[model samples]
Target: MKVGFVSLGCCKNLVDSEQIMGVLRENGHEIVGDPRQADAIVINTCGFIQPAKEESINTIFEMSQYASKLIVTGCLAQRYEETLRSEIPEIDAVIPIRDYGELAEKLQEVLKDAGNGSFSKSERALSGNPWSAYVKISDGCSNRCTYCAIPLIRGNQTSKLLSEVREEIEALAEHGVQEVTLIAQDTTKYGLDNYGRLMLADLIREVDRIEGIRWIRILYMYPDEITEEVLQAMKESSKVLPYFDIPMQHASNRLLKLMNRRGTKEDVLALVSRIREMFPEATLRTTAIVGFPTETEEEFQELLDFVKEVRWDRFGAFTYSREEDTPAWSMSPEVDEQTAQRRLDQLMQVQEQISLESNQKKIGQVVEVLVEEREALTGRYRGRSRADAPDEADGQVIFTSPREIEPGTFVNVRIDEARPYDVAGVLAE
Candidate 1:
């Protein structure tokens, strides 16, 4: 059987998709890039926000048209299994995230007619950039933010064993992976449930010792949990990049309390200040939500002011989504759709200016870029620096090279031009 897989949502979900792909390969099924060429299709979906849910549904319908067997899994399937089974009779199977332990057996039942084959010992069949991959150190969220449905969907945080994480990275390193980004719902809180204490710093140090892994980055760190130990470990590590991806949903103290976030506005300010003082060359990235329940104009202004004060190197914003069963869903005086959209626009506009100014300052600086691809027509190479992640949120570096360069090669480029979200440069002489 040739199986086509569609992975949606964040990097965390992508890791699951890759693991599932590994299962399929181990079971003797061929993986196809196109849905039309598949005997079955698997959609690993996102149900985090309204927009994401819509995309997941749309993709299900789209993929359904291509394959005879349509299997739906991931957050959407986990959250609304019954609804999907009842409403979408076209779906052949609906497997939730919790049931992944039996994924091999379940998939075997679905694809019984397909022949078996041998596969790599690694549990993940990596997709996208072969040289760079995301390694999930943990799954789910313990932080019960009022507005977030993650706790409801994923249950409590379960940190992967330290040895397990190290083994995965070592396998990736052996396979020629140069950059590995450590990801979780809250990376700073890793090992709390399993080891009874935060062990992100230890994990980083362990990864630093791994051979062939040139760059290590950590993402989705809750601001309040970032400790001195973690910071120092990153500072001392030869491989770990100085990239912080802290998602401070809002800046208003009142809003923060309502959202059930741990840090206050002043706390975040001090955290950002301390980080800058510690690593002047560090890249700070953040995300924010606008139009939460009872969000007043003054509160929105406070968030704007916070963004200006922080001047995040890379920023992303989303309007509030009212998901059922969450505390915020029933909160009084919800922000209207128009108001939410307007606030989102205003927030992004401010961020655009900040981003442009931030990128502009990088002009004339020489930076190491992990080459990703070269434009076919223009023949210009495009890649990312330590400042950028593999996600679309970050900027890319485009440069001209006199010589042909392979995709996974890292080279230095001197910045020549800057845009709001991207920088262009020439290969350093």
Candidate 2:
């Protein structure tokens, strides 16, 4: 049977989608790219907030047109099993996330003629660019932030044992993966539930030992948990890129406290200073949430001022989503949708200038780029530098060369031009 899989939301959820496809393939199902050609279609969804949940629902309905059997899994299924089953009459099955291990059995029950075959549990049949992959170090979130429903959705942090992670990395390395992005709900809190202390620094040290892995990137690190030890580990390792992806959320200490985030405004400032002092060349990326409950004009100004002063190399912004069951859901003085969106827009405008400055500085500098693709028409090679993560949400370097280079090969590109989110140049000797 041809099964087309639709992966939605964050990279973490994408990993789950990969595993589902892997199990299905092992159970004698053909994985097809086009939904129209599928006997069944499975959607691995994201129910993180309003926007993501809407996307998941829309995707399910869209696939229903093509698939004879429509299966919904991941966060949306886990969160709204009853609602989806009742409202969406076309949905054949709604497989909850917790029962992912039993995916093969579930499919066999619904896809009768598709046959009965057990999951091999060997390895994931990865999707997307073969040259890049995301290695999820842990599952779930321990930090119960006031406005977040992650703890309610994914439960507590469960760190994969160091040996297990290393084993997975080994498999990925053998699969021709050149770059791996370490991801989790709270990556810095990894091993706290199991090892009783932060093990991210040591984990990097271990993963860096893998032979075929060229670039190692880490993301979703909680602020106030990015230890000096982690920095030291990154600095010492040749493979570990000095790229910090710290999601501070907001700049006002008062707003942060209300949001139930760790660290004060001064603490964040100090941490950023320390990081820049230690690794000046490091690519610092961050994400923020604007228009939290009761956020004053002064507070919004504070955030804008901080962004201008700090000048983050890469930045992303999202408006606060008033999710149900969260502490802030019923909180007073909720910022209206229009106001929240305006704040997000204003914040990003500031970031655009900062990004332009950061990229302009890269002009005339030679950086190592992991070749990702070659444009058949333009004959230009495109790839990522240390600043870019495997997620592709970040920037890339598009360079031209007389010699032929493979997708996974690393080449030095001398940057001569810059864009807000990309750079261009010629391949170096």
Candidate 3:
């Protein structure tokens, strides 16, 4: 059978979809790109926020028109299995997210109505960029942040074995992966569940020893858990870029405490200061929620001030989405959509200026950028520096090379111009 797969949300979820695709291929099933040509459609969804849920629902509906069999999996399926079955008449099956060890067999069981087929076993296929891929170190969330539905959807934290992680990355390196971004519910919490201690730093040191990997970036690190030893490990590894993706949702002590975040205001400030103290040119990226329940202008201002002080190289801000079953859902003084959007705009406006200034500072400095693709029309190459991830959501460096260059080639580019979010440059000899 020709199966079509559509995955949505963060890289962690994407990794799951990749593994599912691998299973489909191993089972002698054809994985088609176009939905119209497939016998069945599989949707690996995200229901992390309100918008994500809407997208997932809409996607299922859209795919349902032509799909005789539609299988819904991932967070949304786990969260709303009964709701989907009752409301969506077209869905054939719903598989909750769980250990996918023998998922090929499971897929056959799900496809019992469609008739069984040959099943083989293999690991996740490399569906993402050839040069870069997301290596999920763990699954689920233990930090029950009040506003987040991750714990409810994905359950508590579970770390993969250190050897398994190493083997995965080693296989990825062998499969032409040059850059690997380690992802988890909380990357800093890796090995904490089963090992009874933090082994993230140790894991990094081990992955850094792998031969073929050029860049290893870790994401979703909790601010307080990032010890000096971790930073030191990052500093020592040539392959490990100094990019800290700390998701400090809010900077106000009151809001943070109310949200059940681990760190205090002082701890956050100290954490940033310490990171900069250790790695002066380290790229700092963070995420924040603008308006939570009962969030006053004073608290917003505190967060704004903190952002200015931290001068994050890349910043992402989202308006608070009041999710169901989360602790904050029933909290009084719910922030209205208008207020939330305004706060979000104000925060992003400040970040725009900060980003421009940050880029301007890089003018004339040669930076190594991994060429991702080239414009056929203009012969311009688009790529990302160490500061940018594979998605290039933060920004990209566009350069015109004297000669044609292939994607995945690392070239030094001298920064010639700066925009609010991107940089224009020329290849440096």
lDDT of each: 0.91, 0.87, 0.88
**1 or 3: which has the higher TM-score?**
1
Local accuracy of candidate 2 as per-residue lDDT tens digits, 1-429: 899999999999988888888878777789999988999998999999999999998998889999889989999898889999999999999998777667777877887645343333447888988878898899889897998888887889999999989988888889888888899998998899999999998898999899899888899888789998988888889888888898889889998999889998788788889988988888888888988899988999999999998788888889999899999999988899899999999988888888888899999999999998999999999998888886646888999999999888889999999898899999999
Candidate 1, residues 253-277: lDDT per residue as tens digits? 9999999999798998898899999
Pick the lDDT winner.
Answer: 1
Clashing pairs in 1: 28-117
- My TM-score estimates for the predictions, one after another, are 0.98, 0.96, 0.96
- What lDDT score goes with residue 87 in model 3? 89
Give the RMSD in angstroms, all C-alphas superposed, for model 3. Answer: 2.0
Q: Model 3: residues >4 Å from true position, as ranges?
A: 99-102, 110-121
Candidate 1 vs candidate 2: the lDDT winner is 1
Ranking by lDDT: 1, 3, 2
Model 1 poorest ten-residue lDDT run: 113-122
Clashes of each: 1, 0, 0
Q: What C-alpha lDDT, on a 0 to 100 scale, does residue 269 get in candidate 3?
A: 81
RMSD of 2: 1.7
Task: Give the range of the ten consecutive residues with the poorest summed lDDT in model 2.
Answer: 113-122
304-392 in candidate 3: lDDT tens per residue? 99999989999998998889898899998988889999999999999999999999999999999999999989899999999997764
lDDT of 1: 0.91
